[model samples]
Target: MRPPFPTPTAEDIRLVSAQLGRLARDVIGIPARCVCGAPTVVATAPRLADGTPFPTLYYLTHPAATAAISELEATQVMNEFSQVLAEDEAMQAAYLLAHETYIADRESILLVPELEGISAGGMPVRVKCLHALAGHSLSVGPGINPIGDLALARCSWTPTVCQCLVYDA
Candidate 1:
């Protein structure tokens, strides 16, 4: 049987957490800190208090609720374990498919017809999401320095918008 979700490695978790933080700051104009009270910077993978490797950053609630720091916060955090299984290629395939649905379901303003003028590229949605998240334009591509190659490899095509959905789902 195939795994049901993409499993980001410890490195993947750390990378995306940092990128999401930067987006929250530079793009969204909101300061992002993990529920654990860390400033959302990437460090070596964190282990359980028992020394088990805990990869993946799981945000359980939307930022507003996170800001309030309500007790319900714990409910929203998806353990990296339960987030999804990535052993199956089908899960990644499903992720891509679900992502396409997410794009089609979203409202957008198109500055370009297609990203590469090849695939559906999602440029329209990218622009909108960046603006909503960072209050900025979609010129934020994978080419940005803080966003290294691994971060790009994770959400390369839909650099600005897709990472949260892809990795965090």
Candidate 2:
């Protein structure tokens, strides 16, 4: 069993979102107009012990500015992470292992990033982060608008699933 919750504060989300946005602007070279178009902001998201955000399911409200941030930042984050995996063989293997586990246990699993670990109590643990879909239209929850269903569809991944398994309990 896991701790069943996320630990990132609203402030942490703000910090990471800001940092990531800066990374996207500086390192990734996405235009400020595009990056800042929707005014990126942070919210409580899940991550793993090594400080990687969880890629699990996320909820979005209709036409929320967060969706734009979610779309751009999510892709940027994954691309950045992909580079890391390309540079480190161990990281690549770890990513594969995590991906395998995720596919094998897709039912109980939501999002599965490599940062998860076992706690001192022998339960699973992960850093808290937000989730967002990149490419297609989805009928997620109530009142979540269809702003970027096409963007989500354009992502390399289909099914476009995202969620965070941890809870505040």
Candidate 3:
């Protein structure tokens, strides 16, 4: 089982801010971290402090993971996954359930009327963004997101290993 979600510490916020290249807003918790202790996925508030409706619940914050997923997307992997979604009924059902679970998880934090029923990574129907799916997968752990698990498996990077974690000496 995955560890309990951790409240972001001041140091965590600093690392996340550096990772994002800006100050992150409305981050509720760090749901997934690298073996080296850098945050890979963050559970954000449904609504930002400025009252913007943010639909992405689990945001990928690690630069290496983000870059790896982006590379996967560039290789037309999403198209392949979309085809899989079309051909595999069982996978489709599971992916749809993943979408629903994502929505429910976000709503449990804070309900945003405009953001209801919309999960990130083009879930349920299409494979839009591997980064988002991978983020969701890492946050929730394996088996919950099939396509996400597949994407992560196909990628050069894996959350099980820490690829990048810079510490100040």
Candidate 4:
């Protein structure tokens, strides 16, 4: 059977490693890409080969994108987003739904009992990691993950523009 997402080519993995400055692990597919076709988000296995239950399904791999999101996180924007989630019932419901969607997407690949109900980036209650949330937004597109969408909007990096040294495989 075919995978749910596009399997990464060897060069895609190499680009991700260069972007991360380390080897990318258990990346089953490239779920999101830049307009120039470089991988923006990688779909990883729910459980690693080492028997670890990995909760992060959509991982941001673009260097510029990750760096921008990291800078945003350093600004303590999550506190403000958490406040929004707290004040807006619609935002809370949408975030909760995003959490559920993330879980379902992961379990569609592999069901890891240990990571049950644990979605990345502090979803359903608060915002924590903009990188992870933005990765999700990039993977699934806008409207699904509101905080992720907001993070993407606030960050300087954009997948619409090619910001990589090498985007072609």
Candidate with best TM-score: 4
* Residue-wise C-alpha lDDT for candidate 4, range 47-152, written one tens digit per residue: 9999998999999988888889989888888899999999999999999999999999999988899998999999878788888888888888899999999999
Ranked by TM-score, top first: 4, 3, 2, 1
lDDT of 1 by residue, 1-169 (tens): 0111233345444444554553221111112333443222222112334554432112222333223233222334222212332343543454345334323322121212222121122222121111121111111222221112122233223222322322241
Model 3 lDDT, residue 41, Cα: 84
lDDT of 2 by residue, 64-145 (tens): 3345446555655545444554676655454344333323322233344453442111111211222332210132211121
| Highest lDDT against the true fold, candidate | 4
lDDT of 3 by residue, 1-169 (tens): 1233567898888888888888878888998889888888888888989989999889999988998988888899888899999999999999999999898888877779999779999988988888889999998888899999999999888877878767431
Off by over 4 Å in 3: 1-4, 167-169
lDDT of 2 at 153: 38
Runs of candidate 2 exceeding 4 Å displacement: 1-75, 107-169
TM-score of candidate 4 to 2 decimals:
0.94
**Once model 4 is optimally superposed onto the true structure by TM-score, how far is the C-alpha of residue 52 displaced, in angstroms?**
0.6
Using Cα atoms with residue i matched to residue i, what is each candidate's TM-score against the true structure?
0.21, 0.25, 0.93, 0.94
lDDT of each: 0.27, 0.31, 0.86, 0.87
Which order, best to worst by lDDT? 4, 3, 2, 1
How close to the true structure is residue 144 of candidate 1, measured as C-alpha lDDT? 22
Candidate 1 to truth, TM: 0.21
- Model 2 lDDT, full chain set: 0.31
